[model samples]
Target chain A: MKKFAELLENLIYSPSTNKKIDLLEGYFKSNNTLENGYALSVLSSNYKMKFIRVSEIKSLMHSKFDKTLFELSYDYVGDLAETISLFWKSNMDIANSKKLPLLSEFIKNCENKPKKKMYDYLFNLLDLSNPTQRWAIIKILSGGLRIGVSEKTVKKALSKYGNKELEKIEKIWHGLNHPYNNLFDWLDNKKPEPIIDNFKTFHPMMLSNPIDEKKDFQILDHKDFVAEWKWDGIRVQIIISNDKVVLFSRNGDDITESFPDITFFSKKNVVIDGELLVGKNCQPSSFNDLQQRLNRKKVSEKIIDEFPAFIKAYDILFFREKRSSKFEFFR
Target chain B: MNILDSRLNIKPLNIFIDPQHPVEKAIISHAHADHAKSGHDKVLATKETIDIMKIRYGENCAKSFQVINYGESLKINDVDITLYPAGHILGSAQILINFKGQKTLVTGDYKTVDDKISTPFELIKCNTLVSEATFGLPIFRHPNANEEIKKIITSLNKNPQSTHLIGCYALGKAQRVINLLRDSGYKETIFIHGALEKICRYYKNSNIKLGNLEKISNLKDFDFKNNIVIAPPSALKDRWSRRFKNKISSQASGWLSIKQRVKQNQIEIPLVISDHCDWNELTKTITNTRAEKVLLTHGNEEALVYWCKQKGIDAFPLSIHGMKEKVEK
Candidate 1:
């Protein structure tokens, strides 16, 4: 009668628009006999939708049905684990490729072994007429390919991300579970603090007793000796005034879209403090080559020049609206 | 066996903090304050060693301790016990017991891969193992703890204003070298310890991935240079690394005897790495858990009970982290 919840509510109003959903391609009839694996596992278990078409679950595996609600909807479509397939591979990459779309008609009607496993994916069939029987339970329940749905579970399924009195957004969504853009401006309340502060705390990071025997920059050069070029990685700060920019890491919170190209000085209200560095032609690059750009909340322009990051400047603390000195912070 | 010896005989063994012991109970297998000690009155750990014993003992130590998470199952008067995870640190388990049908696992210090702090070791069959010779001689294993912290993160990519510290263990060696530099693929920015800063902010507030992190216990505004610091194996020697004289320190336990934590924690090198469990995962958990019987305790338990009875099994070197005057075999 052509109505599996009006074709999964018209494929959930476009979550992956058309990557070949083919509902039954030009209306059913592929050697028509009408069985359709218990209405395609009850329209893929009441709309979690992913019926990657294998000739309609193989003509309901040739009728004579009642397979105990198709073996409990094949363990509810083999529960896509690994954090629900990385929240559907970050809001829908729509997978189906590690080869299984019909392994020669699912190796002769699903063997018997593998009574139940779950995570490392591999079931071997209670038989749905094999088309890599549901992408081999989503590649053994999301073990590889850091995909989908987690920006902190889409910020608790978007009840408007958050803000106001929160016990620290449940302690910053308990160590930040994905969702970004200053976590929707700190769960919607407007994130601010962390203009910048990373007090070196302690290390040989300042030791040099060799500017090659102090060549007259006198009195320690008015105690100036501000040479610079230590640049390893991770010092962070970018403030941007009234129109609000906020990203701070010298022990403050807000990280503005996991370093969206350190907001390349967001229209500069100036607080500056440098060294995020992930370089290429101009030297210094290795915490495994600037860890191919960290924690991303979309920094693509082809990963911003194949991971091109830079900060270098020494210190500023803020300019126009004023507040400078570690003595007008070096130059 | 009558539902397994009335569950070991009603809370059977004792041994945990021990006070002329009569099952005052202290089961612990991993949480390392040298196997979680906190004036116990009762404890039976494993919710990841009661979450590293409520971050190194307190919150009335999980309110007189009683967790049991990783693969739960317990019964004292009949001693069946359970609790496996033991990738070492962060509820680091490995207790396993049985008693009558005799099982006995223990290994409060373990590691069968998966370091970047916790979760990866579970293959424990057991007949009696106990383990932990810290890196039990035979030139002490360890090399890939994410390729030795990717050689201090590829030397902060050729020295981006260098500051690196590293010396860990304010509890589970500085949140497992900040989850092995946030899972060996450094998201950079890391600086913990006010006793490893609030148990690494409650294990990164328990989503547990240890990357893109931060916490140098706010040093106010001393300005040390190109930041990385992780501190504590007792502040890597004094005046807080002499107030950052181009700071570098490093130790990151697994007791850096890499011919001395690269010249005693001056560590221009040394990420040799160690979340315990070495010498081929204590000789492959005494040869794939067909465990004939062995005991060997922490660090140098007489060179792992003389190398697990020179490999013929049936060994014994229990000192429980030795020292405090209790050595003799």
Candidate 2:
């Protein structure tokens, strides 16, 4: 936890991309694989267990410390966890205890606990941890790390440490679970790559790059190029396999729960990359209309009726359990 | 007693301490641009400050100059005045005003932690204490200087193909960073921007042993890998910094303690090396003075004022002209 907190602090302070990668790489090199995997999950905000909420943490702090001072410090610091971490006071003996739990152990303890048990566990954890560790713990429990690191940057660091391509990690990222022992084993070459049988898993999408008109036009041939309408809606990939269908955003986050209307597709076992948009009678609505149905955990009937979502498919990467070749792309 | 008359002045005697505008009789605190301005009629400060002022502004910075050493007493208009070490920069002094046994200490900018370059701070008992609250918040507990300096050494060791460009204020912060590097046993020749050459020379002339320094403009080749370059904060992002092959932008300031500030400045390495006191040091100094009233000046004065009120000390923010905004120190 101390090492993870230091890595988060360094990432927050370092604005340079290369330096952040260096910090993350050094952390991966020094820590154990299980702890590093959990730390990476926390950094990328992919952890499934949220042990405590922000309001509960605030109420717990108010119960222990003076209300007015805590409020004042909160206002000054402009961050709840940081203010509490700096202002929290605990018994010296508890804080100096040598039996501190590791990052993986802490996460394992918090999994599947009752709310009351979780609160007591967090109280004990806060007492036993230093300010930095307390901060990391609170941030992890709150489910928002906001430490200026993107998921891609974490993958880049992993690639640097494991001497693999970033695309390879991103290709298999969404298929893995927390405390990914198999993933680390694969990275360390101690075991074979994990066979992901879940065909609903996300595949890394190829992003488009801007072309310079003056320089790029000199070497290009217009006859060989095909231009498609650039949609302003969000980029999504619809993966339909066997009996399950999933929608992934650009970073491979599963947004299948939000766009239920787009799940009605032919069962051809295919992966289609397209722009998720809202439309009526084949006329696409404004991008603002599509924004009304984004990021919803449970979509209501009225919202689905008002903003009916559909995908404007651009390319089919896979069909009938076979990868589409480049010849099929320009067909 | 009037403490404000168009500028920060003492009534009945008419002495201005670090007044922003030009004044007839001015008691300059330090050679920082905001505190020690030129065009004063008669300027009184330590000899090193006067020399710095002459270097910054021309020799005609003031009509006449009076040099005063630390702890020396001088009588002006029946008011006994003395200077104490402020520990902010070279020759920085805290003015101690004594009139009819009513004492008020004006600390322009000070830090309790002793940086080897400046004279250490001394606590003076006074009736009212005027302090600079640059880092007057509980969250701003600065780490040790040696620890912060070790970060740079570690980075240099880790990335041997990159040049570490540290952005700092030229006067106090630049010299202090150089001195810290030397103290940390960094024997390489530290490169500096052209703007820092004069002030660094001033620091060197004042008997501060800053190891070998070479100006960035003098170097013919651009092979500064694994080297350290000190430049003004503004030059860190400008075209002047593009000369280095792979430069890592870092900043040395108290504001870097805040994550938002570091992100806003795009600082790669944030070294929290401050010239002013942190929250604990500020509160400690104020309490040790045993002053009946406190007047807060500059950065985060409201927080410090609230802190003082909680401790039953009569405190309020002092709004002085040209001192409202914080200059990069």
Candidate 3:
């Protein structure tokens, strides 16, 4: 946990992308798969583990200190775990060991514990572990582990050892779970790669680059260049696969519920990338109409009728595995 | 009661307290890097502080160096000034200035607690007092230096297999911790990084024995077991620390009273050892000075100002636009 905490600290402080990649790679190479996979999961956006709140941490701290003093410390530090860790009176003789439990074991022990028990557990753990390790445990369990490691960068770290492209790991990332033993086994060449079922996963979306003036236009032949009129609406991808329709934003965030009308397209095993506007006609509508029904967990029937969303297809990446299946987005 | 400026050189006297900018005549209070800046035309400080400045910026730190002693009075122009022990560091002093029968005291950085090294703080009666509030918040109650050192020693005994990398400011804190550790009866030679060589040598030259000090050079040959290494805080977090196979990082600062900072720096062992006065000391010093007016500088000024108002003492926060207190090393 100390090494893992140090790795997180290093990653957080490193300013350059290359340095971040180096730190991640170094950590992954030195640590076991359990620790690496958990770290990756902590970095992922889907993980949500709030075993204890800052309020609870504060209450626990009050047990050991004066209430007003703890409040002052909390206000001064501006972080819950940090305030507790700093002012925590430690009896150095009480089961203090340089060795800490593995990251996986620590997480497992924390799960299913009662809140009162967890308070004691965490207090004891904070007493036993050093400040850095204490911070790591609190950060991980509080679900505030934002060290700037994107999902793709994690796959890139995995790619370094396997000699595989980052896309290969990203393809199977959504289907796998944390502490990815099978993923590690495949990367280690101890087992074959796991084949994820049909479009159940999110393929890392291909991003467009800006056209450089001098030579980009020169290399592009008139026949090869395909220019579509750009729309001001939110860019989206409509994935129709495995008898299910899923509408994803340009960044691969699932937004199927936001545009239920657009999910009924009569297509299967196909992913079409396009712009989503709030109009039914072939012409694109103003982005103002789309804004009314966006970023909402639930859209009312009246609003949906007033601003109906539609998608205008621009490019097709995968079509039914039988026709044009062997397509590479980057190449 | 505007004495030495907390800001660098708004007035010429600021150069005396903060010598970042040169001035004609400067009366320095202490030898902490923030207070004793290099490149001054003329510096008037304690004899020990001048020695520390000479070691830091070389013998030519000032065009003319005048050594003053505690309780000694010196007259420059129409100002009558006296130096008093602040009990902050080895050569720390509080300046007492009197002009036309009114007295004002400028304390660079001070603490009431006895560290058994520097001269103890003596109360100086003045009409107005300018004080440092670095740990002025009521939350910042520093633990005893001896107790904090015992924490380090206990950890060292517990984790004998790992090297302890103690992070501190090179000039004062590194030497203070080393002295405290030596006084705790740990006879082993403490390893020090190259950055601390100059200041550590200065302490040695001042007749302070730090007990079997070794300079860390070749990592491959250095022992990693049951050893304590003192280096600048920057060295603790940088690639320099990776050489120790089994190492624990520790930071000694007043800021360790705030936990998030300790965790943010990734310090394993936090020693709440500080040279500046904590909240109680700040208030006590204000009361002890018998000052009618108080000026707070640096840390948690607003809170101190508000507290002073409730106590019926005229107080204000003396802040400069671009001046930052040198809390971090």
Candidate 4:
């Protein structure tokens, strides 16, 4: 019955309306009648999943209103779940409180008095059964909390939590954004493996208006500053090292899904920085020249050459394949 | 159109991108490449614009650009000209020329307020206000910047580990975000996308106090727990976010407020912040300028002109090749 409700809801919305669309669809597919605010708790925990949108639910409700269960959920879910779906943003506590009142009463009175009004009021109303429930509140308060707490502040606070000097942990916090999941593994080993270099890092443009610009760019003395064409194409970093090929943003993200062909080449480990430009004929072209390929999740063999992509390699940061490797220099 | 015309003439040439090219003094408003396209290697703007042109386009392109600044009057053969800040992007200026005693304000893509990117657009009183309505429609009204920033701060506060993947025009957007977040109360490490960090450093070296933001290129460290990460929209979604499974994303853009889905789709959240003036601001600015006539071009200029006409203000969107027009579906 719940699966039927979800499919009927799916018929009304797409993944674009709300990120929560998927999670809600998943909840309904579980084929279970929710008990004692279990619906709100599950959806609240859906933040562990994703957010919900009232507009999406509204569309679902509008069509499903005639059904007995759709009409019945209104009593159990209350105004909070409806609020999030309509506003494109909402408090999980508020949604949870709509199901449970006494808990919401406690939070509104104490823990979150001066700072967070609405969130506190909402959390006080929900079912708080586990100590991990604190993670739940912190998650909603922290915008869909997932994991790997922002270790910078956590590093500072770690003096209390993990009993370590703030500065020492901060050093390790620097590498916190790295891709490897086994974070402490690098520290645990004697010869810690070098970070995977295959991911591309972006360098955001710090542009200057001509009127406010300096007399000239302070060139990093010829050797230090190697200038490239500043290709009109988009900037992208390609990392291929440790037998792992990944594309990362300057923000340190792996974009291997977007440009597969760029990584499909040579199975060896190498990290190179360059522009992701789609060329015409053989030369790099204007930024608009590469617009056609921007959003494609995966490029086909035809696209590989049709745009005839090329990167004007300006910097070489990691290459186990080459002499004078960065690892040897720094370590 | 073959993309040629001579309007309110000035030192460095400015483009209006009209199908029906007006034959007037070719007045160059400012030095941005979008407004400063050239023909035959000889163009006109202000001394400042030409000076800027030299720095950006080089001597060849710069040598061809004519120079003119505010109030430095010169009759380029037959066209009389003047320059003032347009404030749409950086170094932008509105061109005002008195051709045969009839004044026309050629606003080459303008904004009303001063920002980290550039100065506020100057008010110009003219018989005919020829403007690029980048934010022309009534719906394009911009909100109070301070209030908007406050909302941005709240959104950030709500999401502790949010990586603000702001969509920038690359030039101005990056600089604006850096400037806005420079002294923000949040003391987390602010990492700039290497490209943005470099550009921001240039702005700082130029004497603008853009606060201290660490460049991602040099600093090989970050803890998402406290720092604010700024990147273009393209890198925020897809594979760019895989490394950190918990990071939330948001875009700081004028369009963000209007197109809620853009924020919803690109990142988990959206902050309605932008460098461009919104429809309300544009209308208010045009009305306040009290220019007898208004010419609008760019994003929904027709709709903007219609709105102005409804209120009994003479306005119309000039046909131009700005990003919106060229990139429209």
Q: Give the C-alpha miss distance for residue A297 in model 4, angstroms.
A: 42
Tens-place lDDT per residue, model 4, A1-331, is 1223233222222224233444343443343322212322322321122222345434544553333333332432233233222222234445434433232233234334554454334334223311123323322333333222232323333233333455544434333332222333333342453353223333222232454235445532455544346667766667665566666544344556766655446666566666677776548766775776666788777876677666666566556555224454334
Instruction: Give the least accurate 10-residue stretch of model 2 chain A, judged by summed lDDT.
Output: A322-331
Kindly give the stretch of ten consecutive residues in candidate 3 chain B with the minimal lDDT sum: B6-15
Model 4 lDDT per residue over B99-183, tens place:
6776767677666777746667778777777666554433333455555555456756766665544444445666666566654
DockQ of each: 0.01, 0.38, 0.16, 0.01
Interface RMSD of 3: 6.0
Error of 2 at A323 (Å): 4.5
Model 1 alpha-carbon miss at residue A256, Å: 54
lDDT of 3 by residue, B54-164 (tens): 877889988999988999998765678899999888888988887667788888788899877789988898998888888876657787788788878997888789898
> lDDT, candidate 2, residue A229?
88
Ranking by lDDT: 2, 3, 1, 4
Error of 4 at A52 (Å): 23
The 10 consecutive residues of candidate 1 chain B with the worst lDDT sum are B1-10
Give the poorly placed runs of model 3, Cα more than 4 Å off. A53-84, A87-99, A215-218, A241-243, A265-267, A280-282, A321-331, B1-28, B31-45, B48-67, B71-84, B87-90, B95-107, B111-131, B137-296, B302-329
Q: Sort candidate 4 into its docking category.
A: incorrect
Docking class of 2: acceptable
Cα DockQ of the candidate 1 complex: 0.01
Candidate 1 local lDDT, A89-205, one digit each (tens) = 111122222233232122221232242331112322222212222333332222221222222322232222232333333334323321133434443345752122222111012
Scored against the true structure, residue B57 in model 3 reaches a CA lDDT of 80
- Model 3 agreement with the true structure over A57-116: per-residue lDDT tens digits: 666667777676667656877776666555565554553455677777777787868777
